[model samples]
Target chain A: MFHLIKKDLIIQKHLLLLYLIMLTIFIYFQNSSVFIIVLISAIMTLNSFYYDDFFNAHKLMNALPFTRKELVSAKFIGIIVFTSATMIVFMIVSSILNGGIVLLAWQWIVFSLALAMFYGALYIPLIYKLANQNLISIFLFIYVVTAILIPSILDYINEYFPNIILFFYHLPDSQLYSLLLLISVIFYLLSWRLSIKIYEEKEL
Target chain B: MSNILEVDGLRKVYAKSQFVLKDIDFSIPYGSIVGFIGENGAGKTTTMGAILGTLKKDRGAITIFGKKVDVTKPKIREDIGVVFDDMNFSSHLNVDQLAKVMKNIYQQWDNDKYNHYIQLFSLPKKQKIAGFSRGMSMKLSIAVALSHGAKLLILDEATAGLDPVARDDILEVFIDFVKDKDHAIFLSSHITSDIEKIADELIFIKNGEIILKVNKDELLHNYAIVQCRSDTFHEINEDDVLAYITKDEMLNVLVSNKHGLPRGCQISDFTIDDITLLLMKGENNERTHS
Candidate 1:
């Protein structure tokens, strides 16, 4: 499983570099905060789910002595690695830019945990069902539409229900972040288990 | 020696209205090269996939090394080496990296054997698999498959795109693999000639069903093409014959038994390809309700 993950990273090293360079350029030009930069890197880094075996490397993985369970586990663990590494890289770059880690220590913890859970919740089952190709297309389409609709929906709710917004805003940021992180983790585990079940019965 | 691999009543059906495999059954004795011959979409890969536990079977059972194989069980893959037409290695990793990776995956992986086959096959050790030619990649695959000391080699169209020389080299390697009677090979190919030169048993598949399982020597000796005038073709009954096609004045018949040729019929030996064509014809006619 370690070998499988390592191989994936090796294959996608170029893509990783491209993503980092693009984000660095965006950050340099836009004067984006470290949080925003981390968010972008988190999104881009999740593309590893779609691109690592973009050329059908699973064919080779299936041929190996490892069972399908191990292979699927490797893929899930690879996501974890990607998310963690992206966060580390994000922190290093952020620190370099601000001459210090501008992200509050607690915020960094919550953000990293949220990012991992968020991507895992969405990407795992998608890859398990349709694999990289169809999942990538569907994810992109949903992400784009949802990106637009989410803000407008939030603005609408804030405008129409000021009392509810005020009540939620009064909660400590730490508590709110933790709540979201808990929800995300639950979603992530659910997706992971669902993926495992689906992949177990899948025909290679 | 006992049969190395036995499949009984194997069947697979996809959701999209067709059975990919229907009641497939065959057994390969240890060291025998069983040639799996079929048309392009004739369930060869599906059957192999089931045996490897990569695909679920609708109904069937497989036994390897005299133990009932549980498809979901671990380590069944340890004794088998599989090669598919499509290359699966990461493009960025060169041969050295692949070697390290495979070494960890296959418990019995022999570096000496891998290096030996690499040199014998003239594979570049430093080059990335992405840069490999089709033949070179296949050679590399064969090397990896062989390195792990697999008792059974299951190949799915691995020789499809190779030039004659490369094909011959691979054939020779297969011959070497079966030199020890403990080893067995189940090789799937549309190319009949490759099977003719090497296979001990030939299994014919058509439209997702097993048409015939034949011993290679017996198949070659017992079957023949009999040509007769169209007028006399009616004298031959269906039971004694396998299949035949009539063209104008000539009736070309493929018979199962060469000893019982129809009166005034001229008999000639049939190649493996000819037998497969006749089987296809028989299957097609059966399917059409003719």
Candidate 2:
């Protein structure tokens, strides 16, 4: 299972420098480190999925000794791995550029994890289902829309839907975050199980 | 002789299409190469997919290494190497990187052995697999299959698109693979000549059904195509006629027992290709011999 997780890193070894460069650009523009964290995690996660789709690596891996459950588990866990690793990289890069450890609040880290979990949970099963339909391109397309349109949608919500934001603000911060984390965990686990079922039923 | 792989009553039905694997059955004995021959869309790939567990068998029992196989299990798959036509490792990685990926997935991956095959095939270590030509890609795929300490190699059209020289070299590797009594090969290809060259046994599949399985040498020596007229054809035992095609005044008959034919029948020297064409194009009398 470690090997399967490492597989995503191995395939994307050549792209690491480019990903770092993108990170550096985001930092240069002084984008919120939270935005950079979520975006990088999404990119890293989607980058692996993109390569899998490009080479039909799921079929290749299935043909190998790896099981469908292992494959799906690796992707879900790999997101955590890559996201954590990126956070570490972000810290190192920030310190190298600023001559000190410039860290985001602990809340950003938790939010990044929750957001990435949500993204992976939603996409992994869709990727499996789309693999059957051979509509994998839509995955990247959706990624583009989410990357470009999601922030705008959030911005729109903040500007036009103040009462919704006020309702969340009035709620106990601890309880709201705890509830969000619980929902994300349940949804992530459910997606993992769904992906395995879809993959098992698939005729690769 | 003990068999390395045995597939019985294996069937796959595509709900979106009418194609069905009609209780297909065959086996690859240890120390021998079994060639699966069929035309395109004749369920060759589908049958292979089913055996390898890529395609789910609707109804069947597959035994590999004397145990019921769940190809999903990593332990059994560790002993079985697979090579599928136009399907392989990620094209993005170089040959050297590919070895690293395999080493992690397979417990018994041999670096020295992989290097040996790379050297044997003259594959560049630093070059990415995406740059490989059809022959080079095929050689690379075979090299990977052989390097992983596999006891049974199942290949689907492993040498389909290569030049004659490339095909011969690959065929030589296959012949050498089964040198150990513990090793076996079950390769599917439409190229009958390749089968004729290296196969110890042949299993022909048509429209998802296995039509014939015979010893290669026995097929060459005993199977005969006889051209006889209506009177002589009537005299030829119906049991002897494996398949027949009518051409004008002559009944081109393929028979398993060449000596059993009547005197008026004219015997023709035939190749495995001829037998395959006759069997595929003509009517099958029985499953012949398994």
Candidate 3:
């Protein structure tokens, strides 16, 4: 399982230089480092899947001695691993850019972990079930819908869900982080199990 | 014979497809290479997948190492090595990194053996496998399959795209694999000559059925394709004809027993390719129909 998790890093090692430069830019320019870390973590994990699909490596992985369950588990755990590594790098880059070690934002790391898990919870199962081609189409569909519905959805929420929005907005950072983390862990584990079931029956 | 791997009544049906493996059965005895020869879509990959537990079987039993355990289990699969034509390691990784990935994957992965095969196959360690030619890719696949201390190797078209020389070298590796008498190889290929070169036994499949399974030596020495005139064809005993094809005035008959062929008929100089062509194209002997 550790080997399976490490595979993502080994395959993506070539992109390390580019990723470091991007981290520098993000730390220098972006105020919302939380979002940057989350996005970076997602891209890191997605790149591995892209390489796997391009090489048809999933077939080789499933054919190897590892079980479908372990394959799925490695992926879920791999997301956390990538998130942690991304957070560490993001901190170091920010400190270097600021000329000190005063930029260690643990809150950003926690938020990225929560969101990365949530993103993986939604993404991994689709990847297992729908694969690359279909997953792309689904992602496109979601992007288009979100693009077209954002304004109207915001208007609706503002009109009717103002109290709910304000309540979440005013929630203390510690409690909110705890809530999001709890939700992310539950969904991530459930997604891991779902992916395992789908992968076990996959014809690869 | 003590077999390393055995499949009895193995069957698989693709969802929404008419093709099905019709009670396929065969075994690879220890110290032998069993070649599975079949046309494309003849369930060769499907059968290999079933044995490897990559594809679930609709019905059958696959017993390996004399145990009826799930092939997907790590311990069970640890004894097996598999190479699929389309399956490969990540192209982004070079050959050296691939060895690292494999070392972590296979419990019995031998680094020294892997480096030996890499050197033997003349594959560059620093170059990414994506730069490898088809032949080189195949050699690497075989090298990895061999480096793992697997008792049974299941290969699907592992020699398909290689040149004659490269194929010969890989075949030598396979022959060397089963020299221990505790090891066996079950490899599928449409290339009959590759099988003829190394396989101790040959199992032929057409349209998802095992048409024939025989010793390689017996197939070479006893099986013959004799040309027969229509009258001579009718005169030939029905039990003697394995398959037949009519071309103009002559009937090319595939007979398993050439010693008792019709009076004037003689065994022709033939190869496994000819036998495979006849078995694939000609009708069975039960009732001769074009």
Candidate 4:
């Protein structure tokens, strides 16, 4: 499993370097650190899956002495590894640039971790099911459109349904964070199981 | 001698097509090379996929090393090395990097053997596999397969893209691999000459069925291609006729028993290619019993 993770890194070494450079620029120049950090982490995770799809590496790995469950676990572990490493690098850079780890930095770190987890839970199963290039493009198109329209949809809901907004607004910060973490972890585990089932039933 | 691999009653059907693999069965004895010969879409690749557990088998048993194969366990795969027609490795990885990956994946990966094959094949260590020519990519795949302590080597079209010289070299390596009497090779190819050169047994498949399986020596010594006029062809017993095709008023027949041929019929020497063509294009004599 570690070898599989290392293979993904080796194949995507150039893209990883470019991602790091982009994150450094975003941290030094952009003020929206939280959003940038989460976006970069998500892109990195997605890029690994994308490369696997492009090269048909999953089929190769399936022929090796590794189970479908192990393959799925490797991807999840890979995402965590990438997310942790990126956070550590950004934290160090942010601390050096700004005197020390600021209160906002902690918020961004937690938020970014949550965002990465959410995307990982959602996209990993999709990657396994829709391994084709055309299907993946269609999925990305729908996701981008939804991401663009979600804010306006939320605003309309808030305007028309004040009670829903009030309910969420009244929730305690600690409770919200705990709820988000719980949902993300459960969703991720479910996705992992789904991916394994799909992969096992798949015909090379 | 014991068989290294045995497949029985293996069946598969495509959901979107009418094609089906019908009770495919064969085996590879230890220290012998079994050649799988078939045209395109003849279920050769599909059978290999089923054996490797990359494709699910609807009904059948595949026993490797005398034990039933379980894809989930994957421990059995450690002893089998497979190479498909197309390159399966990532393009970004160099030869050395791929070695690192395999070393972790296979429990008995031999770095010295890998390096030996790499040097023997004259493959560059640092160059990415993406830029490799077809022959080079094939050699690299073979190198990787042989590096691990694989008791059985399953190669599908392993010599498809190589020149004659390179194909000969690879075939030699295959011959050497099975020298220990514990190793076996199940090779599938459209190139019958290569099979003739190295195969101990031959299996012919068509339309997802095993049409014939015979020892290479038995095929060469006992099988006969007879040319005769229509009347003499009709005089021969149907049981002796494997397949026959008529061309320009002359009948060319493939018979399993050469001594069964009628007097005055002309017997001609034939190669594996000739036998394959006749079997594929000619009509088979209907069997009286199942």
List the lowest-lDDT window of 10 residues for candidate 2 chain B: B281-290
Question: Which of candidates 1 and 4 reaches a greater lDDT?
Answer: 4
lDDT of 3 by residue, A61-104 (tens): 77778888888888888889988887888878877777888555
On DockQ, the leading prediction is 3
Model 1 ranges off by over 4 Å = A19-48, A51-53, A93-104, A132-134, A137-169, A172-174, B229-240, B260-263, B282-290
The residue pairs that clash in candidate 2, if any, are none
Per-residue lDDT of candidate 1, residues A1-204 (tens digit): 787677566656657777687656655664433344334434454455555457565655665666677776776676567656665666677677768874446666666567556765676676678765666667656655665476798899899998887977998988888887888778877877787788787777
Docking class of 2: medium
lDDT of 1 by residue, B174-262 (tens): 99998989999999988889999899998888888776777888777876778899666667666656667776788677766778666
Least well predicted 10-residue stretch by lDDT in candidate 4 chain B: B281-290
In every candidate, how many clashes are there? 0, 0, 0, 0
Real contacts retained, model 1: 0.48
Give the candidate order by descending TM-score: 2, 3, 4, 1
RMSD of 2: 2.1
Instruction: Give the clash total for candidate 1.
Output: 0
Candidate 1 residue-wise lDDT at B167: 87
- Position B120, candidate 3: lDDT: 92
Model 2 lDDT, residue B220, Cα:
77
Better of 1 and 2 by TM-score: 2
Model 3 chain A worst lDDT window (10 residues): A136-145
Q: Which sequence of candidate numbers ranks them by DockQ, best first? A: 3, 4, 2, 1
Question: Model 2, A1-204: lDDT tens per residue?
Answer: 989878888988888898899888887777767667766776777777777777666656777887878887888898889889888888888877888888866777777788778877888888778753234446546755676777788789889998887887888867777767788889999999999999888887
